[model samples]
Target: MEFKGKLSLWQRIVRAFESFDSWTAFSLNESGRRFGAAYARYAEAMDLFQVRGAKRVGVEILGEGLTLGVGGLLVMLALALPAFREVGGDDWLKKQDLAVTFLDRYGNEVGRRGIRHDDSVSLDEFPDHFLKAVLATEDRRFYEHFGIDVIGTMRAIAVNARASGVVQGGSSLTQQLAKNLFLSNERSLERKIKEAFLALWLEFHLTKSQILKLYLDRAYMGGGSFGAQAAAEFYFGKSIKDVSLSEAAMLAGLFKAPTKYAPHNNLPAARARAADVLSNMVDAGFLTEGQVYAARRNPATPVDRKRETSPDFYLDWAFNELKHLSDDGKLGGDRVLTVRTALDVSIQKQAETAVESMLRQYGDSYDAKQAATVVMDPDGGVRAMVGGRDYGASQFNRATDALRQPGSSFKPFVYTTALLTGKFKPTTIVTDAPLCIGDWCPNNYGRSYSGSMPLATALAKSINTIPVRLSIAIGDGNPKIGRARIIDICRLMGLTTPLVDTVSLPIGAAEVTVLDMTASYAVFANGGKKADPFAAVEVRNSRGDVIYRRDRDLPAPKQIINANVIADMNGMLVKVVEEGTGKKAAIPGVRVAGKTGTTNAYRDAWFVGFTGNLVAGVWFGNDDYQSTNKMTGGSLPAMTWHEMMAPAHQSVELKPIPGVPTTPGGKDAVASASGPKGFEVAASPQRPAVLNPRALDAIGGIDSMMKSIVTRRGPSAFLEPAAETNLFGAARSVGGRMALQ
Candidate 1:
């Protein structure tokens, strides 16, 4: 205006661009200034205005500035046309809603949750007041103008030019709407050009009524809700058409700062904005004079509300499964998916609470910030799974992941193989003396030897020597009973990790995952049938059609071992509970059978077991994979297993180990044996095979005492009647130690 006071058209045009966001504004103004200065010099040289005076020269410069400014703007508009906003399509006009995911919460833990659609209101159902309030509060001249407001732009330019030599926006409703719907709200000439072009395109493509409708329906009201109908219900719990005057005005007030003025976030701000919009509605002739007075006196009300919760952890886990199930969670080429899982809310909650409590109890000692627990039925249907202590803290699922060595837990596989082959009985004696294989010389827990011990006793105590000897006995010529047996057993259990093919496997030298370990125990509980452990039960498509279903035929669980052999193995494992290392795992009333495993240096402590109905595995370890604070399999892991299984067994109808003597005629059927005493006798090879000769010719002090007890007590006193192997039958009362593998 100052330049226009005396300047010509070109000078005023130059001044017009004094306030702009882009470098183009500055560059254009500088060029105009230079041109003006050069023009003044040329004018002085020619004496074009013969009556040259200060006022005349100044007026001439102003005119020249305005002319150049107008022409320059037109040229820039043409050149920067491509950067202008393009009109959005009909579909885009419908509106886009912010996405929210739901989750399955069990106890204090969370599981997989899915997304659901709740947007019920559509475009045509909107009311007239919605448009009136929106226009008054958002774009006051929504129906009367093009996309860009030239006056608003000039006012904003004038204000900005006075401060810090910068220009800010004075965008009208149409221009602001255009920026939201199509162009980005960036302070650049490109963005401004786009906003202007799209504003014009929208004006031509959509009618005044249609534009107003979209602006009302698509405009952000507050919170995460999009569109007016959504905003109406989101703010006042009512439809747009049914909204009261105060409610409508309050909804409109959300335009300035939807979140800040949201009745839910700030009722005072919302009421102030509501009053302002009501006054604007009156000025626009849309509201009555009486309504304005009423609205001013009676403030608009905001609603009590809460944010929709997000299924952060559960959704993340579900997505991972979805990725593996369908093609990256899509079905039939559409990015929609549904999964049916066996996660009963009650059971899931119980499992999660139990697991979390265990973590809290041992959090300091275990130094374990992360843990995973899986509970499954005898048939392998996953009942519950707590993926971590806090899925929000870390997304890595240790339940399905974290494959660690089972240590002595892997011994059962070896013993089971030995039983399956019928080559080594529980009563068969193996050397418990010093053993060193290759560079590894494995020793018992205390480096003490039983000299010679039976298979049942070795397994009962979880002795390291018996597994090596048994593996040699079973997998030797067949190569399928020992080290190979471990690998084969893992393969049979559907494990993907390779196992140690050496003799060390029996003492748990192989790496196995907890899921596989639980499933392997499930096989024993389910009558030696290996069932698949799976979390997903079924999946559906968007059309409510079942795309895939789990085969519940149970497949008869592929008999992995003879029934009697399983029974015998079960019988021996029972002893593990009766007097061996697994006694701490005993559950009341319900018969439980399982193994205890502590790795070398006690780095990983594990207690995994199964009841007649459910199988659960609990592992306590540090993430750095370091030794724990004096933790062992018999400590926290066992306690966790008991804690984990107590609720699962409450209503479960329990069963016994398939081949064990839970009833008569079981394969493990045998005349009970007496406690071990002095039946084992050592004899010199040079002596006769007869008992008296071997017993009389005593080999040593311990041997002579064993011979006297066997001779005095009789063979039945120290012998297990069920033990079929009597390789030393001829020399029962021996003086020297018995020679056995």
Candidate 2:
């Protein structure tokens, strides 16, 4: 409060002494005096002779301990941040909304993928013996400890220390579940820390029984099987609930190493592992010697499924297609779907057999370690795919995933682009001299060049310099523009791999996938239509409601290649198969057209070809990109293609390739000629054939027109025509560009 008037000096001093500020200052002074006295007494006590140094050292140690503890905690939090980020918002726990069961074209059950929420069995459904076996081997103290299992870990550490090696794993089942759910199978201290933290998080969110059930349902049990239920069915042809004690032990043994202990693959090893599991159970008090003796005597025998080969590579690709369709909103959000794919089981077996047989026969000699094959119909429906010789050895899906240089097999695209420019023809003479673009020079396969020859002959012989020369000539001496044109053609025909413009691009320096190469060749096979590769033909919900049908949902394949270009390209490719490097790819009574490609140093060998009915591409190489022993496209890849295609056409009605004359049995008409001169004269398309009355009648009526429209445009033919887009959402036009009159 303000004073009303100035006061005398004595009155002012009294007012200051009575003010609140004076009282606070007096209390602070008194408290400081008392604290000073207490500190003095404490210092005196510490100065005592017996305890002085000890007390000082203890205080320092305590301070250092707090600092180090806090720093270590911060470090741990830093490491745990990534694990927490991996868990991110609990979305990882949500079950997949889509579970798909794949069926072949003939409606046979091929395989199933994705999580089926309805198919998961509870922990109570497992037999007691199986549960005991799993616990005894994987983690005996699972229920007694937190997710870390400190006691079991310590015991395992002691045992391993005594053995001087890692004879036992200290991770709990929960930790394994964490790795399965969120982490890769990497071995590092940071990975262990992340695994431990994630295990703790899982324990916090999920109960013990939930963790057990998830472990049983999600663990991979090999033979391409996942989960205990799938493993039981795949190995014993019975439900997990109905499995015998011996079988249960064997299944439990797979938890350590599924591929190694899989009963279907190695019965003796599987039995030995099961015996170990029994011994573990006895040691853990889950069973007695008397109880385990019977299991040891009567080992489980897996059912004979050696002849049954699931099209695993095909299914993997089809599943990816299904996901794409779902993402594109073509298939609604149905939890369960039955995908009817265009997989021909017979053809798939033939393809697998061909690849395996070829590798077994020539792998050692040629040093070719891996091969990838893809077969699709002319309309782009994938029929059969062999990604590797053995799926169990590697699930890499080389057919769809690996990108290797197409070598001379890519010459067709360059030639097709040249023909599309209206400047090149099959008989156009091209010089096959040493070619150079800038400082880069490409030589012929044998390091010898023919002076000049018809374009068909150059391609038939796979003269490397010819394609390079053509690429430069087509672009008016600018290989970049020519390479871009080739790339555009490849994209138009459904090659999704990104291509680079290089000096050698025209001669197959750019890398491409087997699937796309096969699909690109399909454009010629289908008479100039876009051949966008596809796998799933139909899909239905669990209730059998049609969610997506290829014929009903997809637009007609657009004409992305000109008719003249296709004819020229097909003629050149046919010449390659008939009397050239790709002769080994020829079928006796079939009109086969294809090109052979071998990259530098024989690092990649390819044969991409097609008949009127199907298009197939084969590639041979090592996964490590090692060069084979002089392996050429005309050898192993062509032989494998012929091996598969010969059997694939046995029962089907043969169709003739466009612009190629064929007999009733689909044999090349030129093949019956006596010499190359007669073959060349017969193969040249000098004039169009006259249409017969029956052929005209078949395509003339209004009903025929409507039928053709409906077949091409699907049900949408009754509706308005919308702008067509390719898989990448680019508006598709005729011939992949402005139509030429």
Winning model by TM-score = 2
lDDT of 1 by residue, 1-741 (tens): 343346789876777666444678779999999999999999898786564568878888999999999999998788546644254346556434223222221112232233222334554555566567777666665555676667767877888988856645476766667776776546797777676667776787777766665666556666656667767776777777788777778888776667788888888888887888888898888888796676678776656675443333334545555555554433344333456554444445555665676677666766655556677777786666666776657776666677777788778888877777767788888778776665766788878888777888888888887777666677574434456655776678556676757656678767777777887887777877877776455555556565655664225567876777777777777777667876666655556677888887777777777766678777777666777776767666666666556554443334566655443333233212121122111211121122221232333334445566568665664565532133244344442443311
The lDDT, on a scale of 0 to 1, for candidate 2 is 0.83
| Best candidate according to lDDT | 2
Which residue runs does candidate 1 get wrong by more than 4 Å? 1-112, 118-121, 126-324, 328-340, 359-370, 418-422, 469-485, 497-506, 509-512, 538-548, 551-557, 560-565, 662-741
Residue 163 Cα positional deviation in candidate 2, in Å, after optimal superposition: 1.6
Q: What is the Cα-based TM-score of model 1?
A: 0.54
- lDDT against the true structure, per candidate, is 0.64, 0.83
C-alpha root-mean-square deviation, each candidate: 24.6, 12.5
Q: What is the lDDT of residue 48 in candidate 1?
A: 64
Over the stretch 12-89, how does candidate 2's per-residue lDDT look in tens digits?
888887797888999999999999999999988876744456787987898899999999999989888999777767
Q: What is the lDDT of residue 152 in candidate 1?
A: 60
